[model samples]
Target: MSVSPSSPVRNPWIVLACAATIVTIAMGIRQSSGLFLRPIELELGVGREAFGLAIAVQNLILGLAQPFIGALADRHGAGRVAAAGAAVYALGLILASQSATALGLNLTLGFLVGLAMTGVTFVVVIGAAARAVPPEKRGLAAGIVTAGGSFGQFLLVPLAQGLIGSFGWRETFLIFAALAAAIAVLAIGIAGRPRQQAGISTQSFGEALREASGHSGFWLLNGGFFVCGFHVAFIGTHLPAFLADRGLDPAVGARALALIGLFNIIGSYLFGLSADRFRKKYVLSGIYFGRAAIMALFLSVPFSPLSATLFAAAMGFLWLGTVPLTSGLVGQIFGVRYLSTLFGIVFLFHQLGAFFGAWAAGLAYEATGSYDLAWTASIALALMAGLLNWPIRDAPVARLSMEGAR
Candidate 1:
């Protein structure tokens, strides 16, 4: 297979670096959103479910917008889309800080931020990075970009915590808004549309969707990622509160979330390497099973700050390892022509899982004053996801195989 070099304008290293930076700033601030739950509930006189609902709505909007936005990225390019998204993301954060009611937050944070994220987050950025590299390099390239998000989580979560400590959650958000705006400048570095190298104009987005829909493996991939979304959203949003419910310092949860970010850098990179060397499907299956095992251990073990920290480290290593592998698999099997659009559909399923995960956790805590039921659901889903990924027919689609032959 003779893969062509990227366009002269799209420097692989530069695009990957920009993609990483974008993911860092975007995901870092977004993931820390969970940290504001307690303070927001107190100041706004809203319940946990209210705040959770807002975040839940954000995830839903993100999922709903991905395919259309992804198709646009596929056709046009990510530069303008990402820049506009950065602008909106910054504006949303600024407005969210000024919000006086939960409904106001729902509009600013939930709706606006959710829409902006589709532009700056993995789907758009990963598509750009994938286009900048050859097929063999896609897995590790995706990993490198995903690791950037972990780095942000490591650094920014703690930074947000400190800022909230000294100033307030609203002030912290204003600061993050400034950080969000920076992505627009970086978007220039990643500019370039992906041309179809495999076969020119052989497939349309509708045909791509139709082909994938007929493939059992694609649906299985979606089912597995659904569990991944559930685990990530549930744990990331609720872990700090769960730890606090057991009589620990609020800072402990913050540190734990940071630790997850720190270790995930190594994990995502390693898993990226693993995907290039091993079967992505088996590796994905292992990751899901490992998550289930670790969460089960967390539940059975006695509660302590040390235990929470360890759990964070363990889960963090597994945190986003799925992103590179999942996206990589999509490219490996389907080809990268409409990689962003196809993966966007997969990500929609992921966000659906996230929506349910975030909302259900709040409902569980409100009704039972504990997250035990949510945790159980996460564990069961993880196990189920493990099985779902195991049987995927990990091979290139017929068209890709024919293209490779050419």
Candidate 2:
């Protein structure tokens, strides 16, 4: 890979840094919403399933919109899409504040916010970062950007918890909306004009999808990511409640989420760097297996604040660590020509898992009066994800190379 040494040394790094900042701020507040679930349900007089369903809707809508918005960004520019998304997201929060029913809240908070997330979150931001860096450094660049979201998790979860304790959940959301609006400026900086031609013009988006659809490796990657969504969404939406049920303080849940975010900073970077140096599929396999072992350990031990925090920290290291490696593999196998779209397709699988994870946890807990089955299912799925990754051939598929040659 040839390094493109531009006359200016600082420009590339600055662009990457800006992208990271945007991802961090947006993801931090968004991920922290899990901590708000219990408080909101209590104050608003709603059931756990209702709030859970809203968040599930949010995740599903976001997943559905991601590929389309990512494709738009790939075709057009990230800046305008991000700007529009931020505005919609802020408005969703405002509308959520006035909601009198689950249906109203779900439409505003879940659908609108979820759709907005497509532009502000990883697929768009990381795709931009991937294009900004030199070819050889794309994996590291992707890691740096994704790690920003983890950093946001570390900082935002605790902050949101404190805000909720001091003010109220509704007020907390309003404040978060303000913060989201402020972060939109970073999106503007990153939303450079789209590159019209990146040397893969002959291959249309459909062709790219068709190529990936034919490859068994793509399906394996997608399937494994489904497990990833299940793990993260289940924990994010329910972990706070789980802790409260276990007789731990709500703040402990907040801190646990924070710790997961903090440690993932290290995990994402290390895994991303390793992806460049080692086989990405193997690194992905290890991450999924680690999640399985960690979840089992979390459930096996007596529930305590310390055990919960430890579990979160361990899981955090594995959390979103999948992003850099998976995105890197897509880039390696196909090139960055239609990265946002391909990766968005991959994310749809993740969000589908999220929908089930969020909804099932609530339904199961309500019925069985326990989260044990959900935890056990997560463990089993994690192990399956590990197995799925083990067999993926990360090298470029023949069809892609053949098209490139032509």
Candidate 3:
């Protein structure tokens, strides 16, 4: 379905803050998986491909579950859905820590955690934020929540690296489990039920879904976002290993990741404000072009600590900048009536790209003995994504246009 109307939350800012916090906790733990990769491999003797495959599975499952879970949030309330997911998230982390086999990793890290993330991630939390605030503020609100995820990555990735160094991977995971469990308490603070604006023509979920599916712009949005997912998942999951291949220190990779997260905070915020002020499709186009340029620059130079740090900072600022603009376009064109569901479907395409990004990079590296081919593909994909977003018409659907006509 498409974006929906409004909600009855007392203070919209409170809802925005709580939703952002939930995103921070949930996404932070998820981003740290890469930090666990080398340690888990060294300890368990799991090969990189096997681990990468499991991580790919996690992304696929997360994408697959979003539309369904988002629907549940829209119907039942984001708070309840988030609370339940947090329980599952903590359970998944705990079990993942205990796992010794690849199959166990698939079940715990790939499947369960992936499933739980759908409940707490952008589709649910940002959707809640969208409905809670006035329409004019939705882009900034979505950006704020999206930034929370980046902040978490910035804050937690380094913390996780330190914990992994000091406490060991298993114990570090247990500590993360405790952090994930806190999402439930925070979920209680988000908006519970979506409320219809009085006298406004309300759209059913199916109607919104149909409207979105029929729109050409929606599919273009999905296409562009798929590229975003591929870029983000590939770099986030594999950059550490890529740096290590250049004979750099492991801590360097962690710092690079944290830098990406840190810079992304600025990126998400600036992109959010830009979406509000400019043509969202144009903003999205620029982001994709920026990503292509950054990657190209990273490859042209020697792989050194300074270069890697600079690359991460450049890449991070472009990271997830697409979230607010893409989701904003959905609400802008379709109306915020069923935003969670429509955006969830769009997110599925993103996850498909993520699955391939994570898995394909590993396969390429394993077969070619370097990530050169993957790097080549990433650059090409970014250029193509920029093209995809350039022509997206942001006109509202007939339903929304007609409603406004009244």
Candidate 4:
């Protein structure tokens, strides 16, 4: 439970602060990109499907690169990896500002931004933050860090909307590019050697992979997380457009997104505390089930600004609430040594679902001119995810268990 004298971070709070700041910048900018969809499409005279595909590509690349990026963080240090990612992220935004074609957008926004995100986002930040704290406090620590992203969402979405309304999307991109550069400086605070657990065996990276691969719970966790990606990506990417399609003001969508982010701060922190007290799988199941119910209600009711805000608030409370619990479960079962790599593998599945969610929603809207199919699909997937988590055995792995017994 004690940090070694040689550890770079003598205080866990410093690590949390640095990781939270990095996420605040990286995720804030990334999540707000959806607000640019209509502006970019209108300016370039491109179709929604094309722009959506670009975002979809971004999500796919982000997911695909996570495992490798996470492994790099595991092998090297999170601070350096995250700092490098910040540079890539900033460069990507700058390049994206000048993109005039779908291919250019795809490369800069999708591939480059996504690659940068792999280092700065949850897999690296949360994993590193979790390692800095004691085992008992990992869930709450992860929750506090995950809430940083929600705080970004709350703060940035509205700001991005206003900036786009005034300065144009390209100018806004330039502004965000500058902010991305700041994340590199914050990464230095979290940079350090991995903390060593007292009793856990020193498993090789390959050995850790083999252990996770053989565990049924690991796959179940991945399955449940897939739904998380779908819900968040679809809503984040399309909600503004969806509101506009319903004849609502565009500001309504931005406000709704901000509300979701605001409430998610509370949800993430509370759920993280809950995970420390209850079974993590049960907490995850409850979150997925809540998402299904909330989505269904949002659809069945008449469309109004009030309804949208209410839905946003309700959904926000459930949003990102799963993150700390899911990551905590991984640490509980697998120990924290290779957490970045293992969680990255699980996150890849989440991103795969994200790819489908963002891309398919666009495709469906373009074809049918409605998001009915995507909404219904999300509801069904939420239920499925809830079921998937219910049966997971929330226990320490054999190595950790044996070590504890000794």
Candidate 5:
């Protein structure tokens, strides 16, 4: 039901806060995974590739499942899906702790974890936030939600590192499991029946895909987001290792990643506000271009504590900046009716890129004994993404809107 314009329920800040909290807690757990890698490898006697493959699988599976979860949220209620996801996510972590073999780990942490992630992450969180806020505020809401993930990275990574230092990695997983379980409570605040107006315009899952697939702008948006996945997943998963390789202490890399998370809060909020005031597509295009420029500068300059810190600051600003614009565009083109499902499909592409991004960095480093190639490819992708987004037509697609009523 539509709240009358004057109702307090329509207050944008209230909606933004709810979205931000959900994203923050969910993302915080996901960010802590990097802290587990070395410990799991040491305990299990698995090669880096084995662990890497599991993470890649997780990204791939999460991407694939996102659309389904998003569709369910759009069709039913985000609250129910999120609550279910929290349960599964907690269970997945608990299962991971029990897995004694490589295959078990793969299934538990890899596939099941990915499945759990879909319910809690951007797909569901952003969908609810979108419907809660007005059209003009959607971009800002998306940014706030995305920033919550960054906030998670900032707040949880250090906590994970401390946990690893104090307790064993296996126990860490157990603790994380408990935290995931707690999200079920938060889900209550986010859950409810979909507003009647939002449901009435939702298309079937297949129809939303067909509509998105047919749009050139959607393709460009997808392709650009692919680069975003590449940049973020690569750096998030492997930057610590790179810092260690450059002779900085391991703690330095961890701190740097934490800094990225902390600083990204500012970046995400600023980018979101900019999207609200300006044309979203252009804002996204500029952010991509900025990434390309920053990556180039970072690679050209000699690596050092100062340079690395500066690079992290610059990149953090661009990190997840696409979220506000990309998600906002989905709502703009399709309306909020089927947004979760449609955006989840788009996120699948993003995850596909993330799988490669995270997986490829490991492979590239092992093969070349350096991460230069991966870094270069990231820069090129950013440039290509900037170009591709430049031409996207952001006006509503009327045919799809009509078809959504069926």
Candidate 6:
């Protein structure tokens, strides 16, 4: 028997590969931004609070733009939007390299890069990949695309460190700008065909938004995801400084982040598989609970290089594991027609949490000369997030159910 010319099985892998690679470039560069914080602040003679505020703005803009970008992807094409994002992102990097003040950095890195990321990152790349694959394979496909980000983190963090060390932060940004521009060329592979609006009238965008707004489970998912953003952004942005405060070598922080990235590859894939086989809400709850437990253990133990390494390994495994389950749940409850937009709405909450996490950590440390308060808040939020996911009803929405009945 020959396969049909239009079968997803025939070309799904190719699309997945392209989506994953595009995600790798976008996420790797974003993740490595933390490594430049110290160097940039020192060179520019700015306080940590100012730099952290800039990153906070970036996260805020990324979240705010997600819904619009996702809508654009749903209407136009993921490839075009992502390619355009890459061009803007590269421009932001180039301009950021020349920025001498916090305000300039806020415009270039905070607003432009953040806005560009909405197109190049999950909402566009993962959403396109999820649409390209069969329903059963979406969990795995989302996982693979997300893992690409982890792989980038593992690969690029060290490379970024080397670049910053060898040349300078300005020169490093230039090199990264070139890489970002290259992503525009690579994005063509995952563009897929244009949207076809024939047989799929389950819900209009307004209807879908209204339905999601009325659903308690949807709010629960958003709440849980908010905690995820807070934890991830805070740690990713501040871990290096935290480690330095603990008297560990700078290399230890880099190594720790690398370990997290490496283990995240395993965790993302496994959780993706788990979501396919188990209750997605339960899986998400477990991830959040596990994060809380791991953080508690790390805090209880004495601070040392060995302890820090162990913390990194444990935290890395749980780092991005929430993404697959959260996204899968969104697609599961609502159909894929509006997946990008719905998920983008949820992501806005996540970014809001991230803004506070990144900015507040800096403020707390600056005021108190310690990260102890941030650590406590993360643990509390993790526990709260776990509780939030526990009660989320993961059943299909009424619209999908009605469509299925018909």
The lDDT of each candidate is: 0.90, 0.84, 0.89, 0.90, 0.81, 0.86
Give candidate 3's TM-score.
0.98
- Give the alpha carbon lDDT tens digit for every residue of 10-72 in model 5: 544555576677778778877767667777777888755567677778889999889888888
The runs of at least 3 residues in candidate 4 whose Cα sits more than 4 Å from the true structure, single-residue gaps closed, are 1-8, 195-201
RMSD of 3: 2.2
TM-score, one value per model:
0.97, 0.95, 0.98, 0.97, 0.92, 0.96
**Model 3 whole-model lDDT (C-alpha atoms):** 0.89
Clashing pairs in 2: 79-191
Tens digits of per-residue lDDT, candidate 6, 266-340, equal 998998888788999988989989999999999998888999889988999988889888999999988677788
Regions of candidate 2 where Cα sits further than 4 Å from its true position? 1-10, 196-201, 399-406
Error of 2 at 223 (Å): 0.4
Model 2 lDDT per residue over 100-170, tens place: 78898789878988998898888888787777767678888889988999999999898998898899878
How many residue pairs clash (N, CA or C atoms closer than 3 angstroms) in each of the candidate models, in the order given?
Answer: 0, 1, 11, 0, 1, 0
Kindly report which residue pairs in candidate 1 clash with one another.
none
Candidate 1 displacement at residue 79 in angstroms: 1.0
- Of candidate 6, the 10-residue stretch with the lowest lDDT total is 1-10
RMSD of each: 1.6, 2.4, 2.2, 1.5, 3.0, 2.1
Residue 65 Cα positional deviation in candidate 2, in Å, after optimal superposition: 1.2
Give the TM-score comparing model 1 with the true structure, all chains together.
0.97
Please say which candidate is ahead in TM-score: 1 or 6.
1
RMSD of 1: 1.6
Model 6 misplaced stretches (Cα beyond 4 Å): 1-10, 193-202
